[model samples]
Target: MNPAPDPELALEVLTDLVRTDLEACNRLIVERMQSPVALIPQLAAHLVAAGGKRIRPLLTLAAARLCGHRGQRHVALAACVEFIHTATLLHDDVVDESALRRGAPSANAVFGNKPSVLVGDFLFARAFQIMVADGSLRVLDILATASATIAEGEVLQLVTQNDTATTEEQYLQVIEGKTAALFAAATEVGAVVAERPQAEAEAMREYGHCLGVAFQLVDDALDYSASQAALGKTVGDDFREGKITLPVLLAFATADETERGFWRRVLEERDQSESDLDRAIGLMQARGTLQATITRAREYGARALEALSIFPDGAERRALAGIVEFCIARAR
Candidate 1:
């Protein structure tokens, strides 16, 4: 049997690779963002310097190396993918009116919405330029499709805001579009660049899809369950923003009709209060919905791991396989 996956092996494989491309990404971002007006460069650089996981591009590089690719272009492409993701985040924070990310003020909050949104558009344009320079029509196609899906997912979440009736299916679609599609695309492009067989390429794509889903599910779960110190944001940020995340969805189902009055007030009524959050948390815990939410995330994690068995055993493959647990249990 294959050996058990290394828990931190993903982090290990990512260490040097992420560092190298992060430097390149930083350079490229600065080079492309320069303008006659200095504010553009200044604001964009501030957020880029703010720091993030940069996991999107790291996934690309790791996936490519795992599939036996040796070309230097993968590094450039990975950085390009990260820029696209970062751009989206700048835009997202503005749209969500979120104040904090990774324990700091968001780009929109600091630079104001106009600069954040405009800079985001500039990044998107720069990403496309870099992607096309690869001269791979297939790469452009996948990235295009994934980008459109991301837009749709964001709109879906916006439309579904505070709608307690948001179904699991709807939630899945939103997550797939908004978060997982990019992950799937980034990893899939790695396999595609390596000229892996169609089946294996498809396997990597599915692995990314499932892994992205699990990652977002756990992120949503953490919003309700983790403390600000641990999560780097307040619990119930979802509720405050009228987001009906997985834990909230479960709580809606499991809460008694009487107790659900509290949910309705917090999620539905315009007059939501601080006490409403306390009551909702208590009711959700009492009904075990928070645990159920974690269980739901675990099931996705299992599926993500299942998709990885297709690749042959190696440190890279093992690390890829182990990432599911990290994504699912990241709250701890």
Candidate 2:
């Protein structure tokens, strides 16, 4: 059997493989985010500088390379992917009323919700500009549809929030729209830029879709199981928000009547106390819901690997596979 993959090492390998392209993408991100409004760039830069892993953009660059792309188009497109992602983050934080991001005060917290929303709009506009400059209606459609799907996903999450009866199918739909849509677009656009066959492009999209699902699943598990330092955000943020993630769903599935009442009071009623988060975690631990969530993530990760099998064996393919492992390893 393959040795267990290291999340940090897998991430580092993929980052190193696309180091130069990633640098160019970063520079482009800085340049495009600038505006005379001052606050636009300042607030935008705050989140950019806060520095998440840049996994989406990295996927774009790596996907292009894997498709044998030689042009510089992938760099600019990668930046576009990041702009779209950052824009979503800005909007999401406002919606979630999240105070912290990447271990720092979120933009909405620092700049206020109004500016955060507007800057997020500005970033979306910037992403469109990049897409237009690429002059490919196909790429534009892919990313634009993703943007809309993300909004729809967020809205769907709102509909399901505080409701313990959310089905796994509904949860999957929400995540597909909010999280996986852009991942699908990011990787698909690489193939488009490389002028690869449609079959290849679809394969990449499949890989990304599965990977995004896996990534978000692990994130949900970590919310209840990991430290703030390790998670890069507050633990129990989802619980506090009443978000019906997989772990919560799994726990609820097996909950006795008393435990069900506890979930309802905390999640549906939002009547949480200081001890509630601890109790929630304890219940999840006893139910092994966290591990069950991780197991679900691994299943999606396996599908992501299968999607990559269409491509030939090479460093790019391995790097992409490593990404799948990296995402799943977070829960372990």
lDDT of 1 at 237: 82
| Model number with the top TM-score | 2
Residue runs of model 1 more than 4 Å from their true location after superposition: 1-13, 17-30
How far does residue 197 in candidate 2 sit from its true spot (Å)? Answer: 1.0
**Residue-by-residue lDDT tens digits, candidate 1, 266-313:** 777746865877776777787777777678777877777777788777
Residue pair clashes in candidate 1: none
Candidate 2 residue 16 C-alpha distance from true site, Å: 0.7
- Models, CA RMSD each: 2.1, 1.3
Candidate 1: global Cα-lDDT? 0.78
CA lDDT, every prediction?
0.78, 0.92
Q: Model 2, residue 77: displacement in angstroms?
A: 0.7
**Residue 161 miss distance in model 2 (angstroms):** 0.3
